[model samples]
Target: MTNTETQVPLARFGISAVEIARVVAVFYARVRSHEVLGPVFAAHVADWPEHEDKIARFWRNAILREKSYSGNPMREHVSRPDVKAEHFPLWLGLFHDVLRTELPERTALQWGALADRIGEGFRTGIVAMRQPKDQPPKLF
Candidate 1:
């Protein structure tokens, strides 16, 4: 079978809390070592312990559909003037890598698509907030 044909289906595997934890742990490990994004993330997330828990919970809600993680991710980053539109793609790539490492291929793509949509939405919203009301929304 071709590689694509052998890929697992999203419905075949259920998302669990353990999977969420694994994704968070692996993703942060990469983030901490990432050349382009490490300093940016470190400068913003001063309290690693608290940040880790919040990230875990956010992934849990996103993957498992448990309690809604209603935190405004855009608001969290709005104050960080260094964060720009280019950063979103790097973040999405890292997130996709984490999902692929922790989940099946199909599941990874599914999660990646969701992350892309969310990241685009958040990025657009953040840029919009930065713009004057008279200006049109910036396209990502």
Candidate 2:
């Protein structure tokens, strides 16, 4: 079977809270230093520790389904005028890189898939938000 035909079992390779914290820490460190994404993130996130913790909560909720993430991520991303659809790919690419470097293959793939979906959703939301006021709203 082709690689695409193989299904990754959802519950088999779960990430621990410590792993999540590690990923978040390393990932943001890279992001903070990146040429393309760094300035954009720095402009909005004045407090790194608070922002990192919030992001960890987001990933914890996403990967472990812990229900700890309460913020409206799409709304938050949309509010950042410097954030464009073009940046989402950069962000996701960085995320994928960190996951591959820090995690086992199956674990990285699982988290990467979830990150991709979230990135796509954020991209779509940002694009829809950019549409002219007269245009009909895109389905959420």
Candidate 3:
């Protein structure tokens, strides 16, 4: 586990709650209008504003260690049959576009790197979920 004291704060990279909120708001707006992502999110999210607020909180918790957000992101995504593993790339592409446009180059690069790492985690979890229960972990 990473010690909070040792971990570098995202704010050092110019990632504040304000920046998190902006990214969530703008990225989701594009997602809602996107040809591929729109339908997937629309089916689950009833209130756009409320969903955005929750997502912003999630980003704050993740990036800022606010400890104010709730819900299991991996469980949420894995539960959705429509959220295929391939969708991670699509999601990251749009998120990267939003991050680059909303933040300065250095900040965007840092934040995008973090997002890439997290997206890989989610994709790995989803892949594990699809594995056969009777199958044992491979021995190297």
**With candidate 2 superimposed using the best TM-score fit, by how many Å does residue 77's alpha carbon deviate from the native?**
0.6
Range of the 10 consecutive residues with the lowest summed lDDT in candidate 3: 6-15
Whole-model lDDT, model 3: 0.87
The Cα RMSD of model 2 versus the native structure comes to 7.0
Whole-model Cα lDDT of every candidate shown, in order: 0.79, 0.88, 0.87
Better candidate number, 1 or 3, judged by lDDT: 3
Misplaced by over 4 Å in model 3 are 1-12, 134-140
lDDT string for model 3 (63-139, tens) is: 78787799999999999988877888999999999998999999889889989999988988887887688998432
Cα lDDT tens digits, model 1, 1-140, are 76459763333236777777778878888998999889889888888777888988886776665564779788887777888767888989999988987899987888788789988877787787788889877665
| lDDT of model 3 at position 64 | 83
Q: What lDDT score is found at residue 59 in candidate 3?
A: 76
Model 3 TM-score (2 dp): 0.85
Report model 1's TM-score to 2 decimal places.
0.81
Tens digits of per-residue lDDT, candidate 2, 59-100, equal 877776667789898999898899998999999999999999
